[model samples]
Target: MNEIIRLEHVSMAFRMDLNRTTSLKEWMVTLLKGQHRHKDFFALNDVSFSVQRGDVVGLIGHNGSGKSTVLKIISGIYKPTQGKVTVDGHIAPMLELGSGFDYELSGDKNIFLNGAILGFNEKFLQEKHDEIVAFSELDDFINMPLKTYSSGMLMRLAFSIATIIEPEILIVDEILSVGDAHFQKKSRERMRQLMEGGTTVLFVSHDITEIRKMCSSVLWLDHGKIQMYGDAVAVCDAYQAAMI
Candidate 1:
């Protein structure tokens, strides 16, 4: 099997300063007074995992269980403070809603910008532009500024653009809950299509049913560490039972 993603002994630490000086003046005063102090918080601890090509993996955990941190590391948005992350393919990450979006720009223009951010050339984006708009069902509002869009509309556009080009790896973090039921169904169908094309997907969702239905494997993270990882049904069942 080909390994598409690997995290070996990954650990992430964030420093929380005791005194948060908002202004430069306050910061300078604190520096001069030598009162700055910070405590470290590890979001992930010695995490190790490897994803093979064509695997659909789900990440399940509590709100502060570091699921988002894992996804960010995989997306190359943040470097691991310790250990290593190896990604063998291009990643299309649909993280928090409204990320990488310019509210002041028209939806059409933002599409190009987002495409560029995803490493797509203008020629390629132009070629896939119609398909993206068609899938998003935002033909009438495509030229309008994104600031006027609702959360659902914004997600629709983002999802469409992210899925337009098939990526080797797709990273989704709590994004399946954004749109209406119909749109969510459409998006799932698109994801299934991508899977048919051999895309490896790493997904994070609170919905255990969705995870079981869509994922082949599950990694349950708790307290910044992997609690269990294996078959989706077994891991999710264990996690769900533990919660009850």
Candidate 2:
């Protein structure tokens, strides 16, 4: 397998204000006095990893462990504060459902809109329109405005469009159970199909069982640092033991 994703000492940091000034006047006063309390918080601390083409890798960590930060950096939603990151394939990120959508627009229009945003041409979207709708099971609500739909409905449409492209690299962030139990099963089946067809996948999930079952390898993170990286069972076993 060829290397498709790599990170060299990649680190992401954010400047967080230590003082919470309620008024603009107070904030300006602190700024002028050079007393604006701020500190750099490292979300990813000199992290490094590589993933091969056609590999399914799972990222596991506790809340606020920077798992989402890593995904955002890999998705180009964020630039690492330090170190180099490289990706050799096109990425479809499902980090935020309906993130590319226009709420005022009808679902049908958003389909074309989101598909275009994902880099698909009009002709291709037209060809796959029916299939996407069928998979989402949103035939009745396809004409309604997105603002009128429920969160689960929006996620269904987003997942349908994103996976329909069969992207070279798919980034999923805890969206396996996007809808009801029925749709959750369907989504998992679809994800399995994508993996079987050799789409490189990097996903973050809290469910260790799902990670061990779906991922060939696991990247365990703790406090923005790598805890383990190896075979699914091995890494997960280590992480689970540590948690206990």
Candidate 3:
């Protein structure tokens, strides 16, 4: 398989203020006194990886190990503080629940809005609207504002929108189980179909069993660094053992 995604010596750093200031005046006073301090927190440190086309790669890590950071960089949501990221295909990223949604707008409107952000034209979204709603089983709530919906409702809408386009690459970040058990099964089957149809997928999940089952390869991250990267079964087995 040809390479579809690659990250070279990638590092993402954020400036964190050391001092907490409650008000603008206090912040200004600290700055004027030269007492303000900031530290660079590296969410990803010199990480390198390459994914081939049609690969289902699972990212496993602790809560703050930069798994989400890696996905964001690959999805173009975040730019690395250092190094280069290359993606060769159109990406459908379900990085976060309701990420591209307008909460105040009805779910109906969000369908078009989010679809456009994913590079679909209004006409295309219009054509797929019914199918998306049908699959989500959100027909009753489709005309209601998103802010009123529960988390499961949001997940259903987001998953429907992200998968309807059949993108060349799909990026999922710990969202597969957000829905109800029935929907979870449906989503997993959908994911399997996508993988079988040769969609390159990069996903972050803490569920090692799911990772081993769905992934052809696994990338284990720890403390913002790669701990292991190899065959799914080998890396997952090592990661599980390390967790114990």
* Residue 226 error, candidate 2, Å: 0.6
> Candidate 2 has what TM-score?
0.94
* TM-score of every prediction relative to native: 0.93, 0.94, 0.91
Q: State the lDDT of candidate 3 residue by residue for 127-244, as single tens digits.
A: 9999999989997899999999998899899898888877899998887785899999998889889988999999888888889889999999998999999899999889889889
Question: What tens digits encode model 1's per-residue C-alpha lDDT throughout 1-244?
Answer: 9899999999999888888778999899999999887788999999999999999999999999999999999999889999999999988877864477889999999999988887889999999999989999998899999999988899999889888988999888877654899999998888889877899999988999989899999999998999999999999889989999
Best by lDDT: 2
Better of 1 and 3 by TM-score: 1
What is the TM-score of candidate 3? 0.91
Which one wins on TM-score? Answer: 2
Give lDDT: candidate 2, residue 166.
Answer: 82
In model 2, pairs of residues that clash are none
Q: Hey, what RMSD does candidate 1 come out at?
A: 1.7
Arranged by lDDT, best first: 2, 3, 1
Pairs clashing within candidate 3? none
What's the true lDDT of residue 11 in model 1?
97
